[model samples]
Target chain A: MATEGEGSGFAIHPMDQFVIKPLFGGEHVHWYTISNVTLWMALAVLCIVLLLVVGTAKRSIIPSRVQSVAELVYGFIYNMVEEVTGHDGVKYFPYVMTLFLFILFSNLLGLLPMSFATTSHVAVTVVLALMVFVGVTVLGFMRKGVGFLGMFWVSSAPLALRPILALIEVISYFVRPVSHSIRLAGNILAGHAVIKVIAGFATLVVASPFVVGAVGAIYGLELLVAVVQAYVFTILTCVYLRDAVGDAHH
Target chain B: MATGTETAAEAAGHGGGHAVGMPQLDFSTWPHQIFWLLVTLVVIYLVLTRLALPRIGGVLAERSGIITKDIAIADDLKQKALKAERAYNDALAQARADAARIVAEARAAIQADLDAATARADAQIMAKAAESEGRISEIRAGALDAVTEVAQDTAHEIVAALGGKADAGSITAAVAARLKE
Candidate 1:
């Protein structure tokens, strides 16, 4: 009376890492680690490099299909930069375009079975976030110098509370990178982990086709989540870049 | 401070949870960052500044050349039309001059013919006048003789009717009367 292939099912924690390390770590440090997350990151970079190289190799009056696609991506990023940062934003087009392409490729790569979502890892996300934070902070100082510090305070508040407000502003500024990294990692980790849990249930429950169908539907929904998360990350990066260059109220 | 080997051993046993504890600001990552950033920046700059912009500029230049060439052709056509009009006007003027010359020549020829006809008429009149002069004198003499005869006849008839004297003085009077008539 029992259905086949029914068991409690093997559970996998979303934080699991498959590490690959070398023998020595001295002057000529021969060390390499291949984790699920790192694998997807490397793949994303490769994809982006290939796209850039192949798309622009042949410069023609009348563009080929690949060239047009590259142009479209360029135009899209250009407009996005212009809209957020106004006229001065065009100078940052290259950075914004790279960010979009990298995150988009990484997200898509993670969608593959057994592939790690690098963005889901706090370390990787933190690195990217910190890079933005440091870059923006340096830019602000370079552009405005000592005056840039005033960006945190001197809002429409009363002059009496300016000191307290400035302290609060400093704290908020420090939290920026942490929040940015956590937002990306949390969304990706939750989605992938939910899918994994549902899939595991589907494997364990052989008697109910309904349960399997439900899990399949959730998996399909996860695909949409993956793309949405990538878009959100890119857009947020753009917003941050705009704030970095423009008025601090952003 | 755990050695590299200890960290790996710990990572293996704990499933790589060591990455979550505290982030070590690895100086090694800086080289990678700088290298990648420079590579990206240079490649993008070369593509946009060198390749794409130049191609777009060439297309614009070629279009300008075509438009200027078209204008030149139009100007040339206009000049040719003006030249043709001038030639047509010159040919018409020549034809008008030729017509005026032919008309003047025809008028002169007609005038010469009229002068010759007038001269011929004057010569005929002179010749006729000379020939008619002698005939006219002979006619006058004959007429005078006929008048004397008629008078003598008439006087004789009258004297015979009257039966008075028939003298020389009466006869002379009768001759004078007949001449008067």
Candidate 2:
């Protein structure tokens, strides 16, 4: 039997990465690069497509259990949209539901042994954030024209302080996507790093079953955090979309 | 110099200077933000346009159709009920008119019967009065004949008691003398 460190240290752990230059070598890439993250994202998208197609292929007056579950999910998202964005929010229900389901599944997939957590990468998260940011901005402008600019200004504040308030508001509005992206990436990366460090330490200590058990418990906890983080990200996206389309006063 | 010192420390710990641990953050390899941004936008756009929006629209349309059909069925039932109510009222009015005609006819028949009975009773009373008048006249004639017979018998007895050949004036004088003595 091979010792613990004998077989290339657990076969490189799949997602573990180090910087390397290609043979042609104008640029360098990490072991777990953007290409890997893109592949996983595509996989997650495919999973969602398969889920929807399979869930809704058969239509029945009294639905089968699978179809009922699918309808329940649809209703849950619809109610959430209505709660956050009122009745008009229903039009955007599909986009919001897909975003939620895709991210949730991706996060769960990452929890499997040797699976890559694509959400841990800042680039991928940033792209998701930027999409939301641009989408809302476009919708705002399309709905309200030049008046969309007034969302940052023309608050219920007194006229004398309007300029100063508007400046702060504009800066905050610009920071929305950055904060959104960073919050998700930071949480995922930190959680994974901690688990990795603990597991590494666990290997060093022998005759300490307690330590191993504790680490196992923490791993379970990390799975819960994964789901929660996905939910939080999707809910925040909905709130931002609501602000973009709805009246600012509300 | 710092790199040399780190390599020396690693070599002292192990036979070689191969660092084996988690990698440090390298922000330099970050992708151009615009490229990823465009990719995400396109993905979101496609998702909304191709999949999400159509499903939501189908659900809403199905729900609307159900509601409209329910309303139409409700309206049809209401119209039927209204027609039934109108027909019932018409039947009730016709019944009332028939009842009134029957009542009037019964009252007229009773009035005619009473007038005919009153005429018959008056004729019976007139016939009884004429029979009673004829019985009263016969009884008066019988009483007058009895009075005449009694007067003739008294006159004969008085003549037999006086004498055999005595005239009426002598007998009258003799009877007066006998009474005076």
Candidate 3:
């Protein structure tokens, strides 16, 4: 399968890092199968529990390190929801917090050596994005009823251009989940793949030093990406929520 | 290096002897990934909604509430201190005024006593001076009478030595006139 150029003991399979393998060692990944995806995701859940539950068990006025971390994450997402969705949107704080913690831990945990990045997969991110999309759509309809469709309709535009503007608005609205999921998956997938490709070059004895240095630098960047991607996803969720809960800007 | 190559070969075998384009695009694993993702999301949602968020929110609210209560108590204490200081100042001013009044009253009382003593002393001195003056006049009167009697006796003896015999009544009359002059 090697193009003759890479046959000289210099091979790079960047995508292999994303492949799902059963945790208990099986070739087939059945729907109910316990795979690496479950392990990392479960680890993320454990981390969330430890930070949120056990860390704050004392319920101290002055928080411990872990408790403060939990509180900081809580406050950060809480404030984001409050600011973006306004006062009325604070009801959705837990949902947004859940999304942020899951993505954040998944991305960070995936950076470990030989660990599968669950967020790097489109299948995982699409479900997350769709949840937000569907939840927001239902909430918008529930709260504002038919007036929710008014979001796509640009009322301020000229009557003749209103339909065109709305068409664009509707397209963009539907495209939100696609773009949202792709953005996160693409970023993680790209960063991991780039690092893998660079590491593959370490086989050439001369490039080994540069490769190591580059990998370190890219790893640092990926850490920042992991956090930023989480923030972006959470903030976008809040922005969508604003449409449902907040007063109409149009 | 051997393990790396072995894993690479094994991955290739899994990929049908070629690297898969993108494991993300593999539809066969989508359902598996989706199911777990849903499970993970549900668990997280439940954990957060049930436990974490409410606790954190309660802690924050409680902290702010404590801070606000502390501030209010501090403010109340400050006001009380100010009131106490004002009361202290008022009492000090009142005591100062009372002390001044007492001193003035004491001074007035002492002055009245001194004035009364001085007036009494003057009345006594005046009475003693009047009595002394009355005694001096009486003594002057007595000395005048003695001088008059002596002059009469001398006049009578002189007339007798001159061998001039006079009547007793005349002699007495002449002595009386001379004494009068």
Candidate 4:
């Protein structure tokens, strides 16, 4: 791709930014290798710590700036879990909060110059989505026994159409993880890649101003996307969890 | 030209690991990315579950609890204030009623005293008038007797001057009859 772009009178290797490279300078990437992924992930962890742990060290009834942010995020995710999954699903709050904060911080950090976006990769998002998927499935079985399969049965459907609806329900149920993971990975990947491609045009002196303005606009949009994607991912997890722990009224 | 050659050389060297298509599909780096991602997720999970979530949750709960308690206290204070105002109003009414009663009692006492004084003055005036009436009647009776005697003496002198004998018994009887008339 770089060579092709070189032939086209411009050098733009947009995918280069997503390349995995060791931090200490080496050609090899091992499972134990410390890479840019580690650094950015560590930064996210630090941000979480600063906002959640140290910011609230005083336990003040009136919160400081960082403490209030921490409290807002907590209440936001906690209420989401409680409302979507109902009261019983409140136990999974920590898991949902973990994913939300990690994705939210990663997406925002990736917007910085020369920063790597961890959530843009399929591997990371796949693990996250699968965790929610497997957990909800297992919890459904545990809580409802064989009754969990009844979700796909669609008892409200007419008897003649019940089988077809059940088949559709089952297929959609299995597709959740794929759609869940791809939705997040695709959004981040596309946004970052678009920005890179637009920035590549800035190499020309004439287009630099417009490129800068466009990139700025996209950056603002990406910021909204970052928070929104995180919210969507968490709320979807809560919705899936509701199938497991929610009442049988549906 | 030299830098371009070096960059090409570097790219050639990394050809073993470089992604020809999307870096996201680079099969060789999957293990490395997956491992780091797992570590990150685990660390985040532990940090949140063990530290962050509980603290934030506690702070939120405590804040709401404090707010509810404060509201309760404010309500209690309002009730107390209302009670105090009612007590103050009741005391004011009681004082006003007492003042009116005291004024009425004082007015009644003053009216009784004034009536007694008027009665005593009237009795004294009546007694003085009666005693003056007795003295006046006594003086009138004495004057009548003196007038009769004077009349008798004058009559006797008139007869003597006319060269007629004057009898004391007839003159006395005539004076007496004249006085009676």
* Model 4: colliding residue pairs: none
Error of 4 at A231 (Å): 0.4
- Compose the digit string of candidate 2's lDDT tens values, residues B39-157: 54456447645764455446545766877998999999999999999999999999999999999999999989988988887788778777777877777766655544444344446
Rank ordering of all candidates by lDDT, starting from the highest = 3, 4, 2, 1
lDDT of 4: 0.86
Among incorrect, acceptable, medium and high, the docking class of model 3 is acceptable
DockQ of each: 0.03, 0.04, 0.31, 0.32
Q: Which 10 residues in a row give candidate 4 chain B its minimum summed lDDT?
A: B1-10
Question: Highest lDDT among the candidates is held by which one?
Answer: 3
Better of 2 and 4 by TM-score: 4
List, residue by residue over A54-169, the lDDT tens digit for candidate 2: 55555444456765665666677777888887677778876787677666667777666656576676766787888789998899889889888887776688888899989888
lDDT of 1 by residue, B113-150 (tens): 98898798888877887778777878888888877877
With a 3 Å backbone cut-off (N, CA, C), the pairs that clash in candidate 3 are: none
Residue-level lDDT of model 3, residues A121-140, one tens digit each, is 99899999999999999999
User: What CAPRI-style quality would you assign to candidate 1?
Assistant: incorrect
**Cα error, candidate 4, residue B57 (Å):** 1.9
- Alpha-carbon deviation at B90 in model 1, angstroms: 30
lDDT score, candidate 2, position B142: 69
Q: Which residue ranges in model 2 land beyond 4 Å of their true spot?
A: A1-35, A206-208, B1-181
Best candidate (score: TM-score): 4
Which has the greatest DockQ? Answer: 4
Show the lowest summed lDDT stretch of 10 residues, model 3 chain B: B1-10
TM-score of 4: 0.80
Spell out the clash pairs found in candidate 1.
none
Task: Give me the TM-scores for chain A across all models, comma-separated.
Answer: 0.79, 0.79, 0.97, 0.97
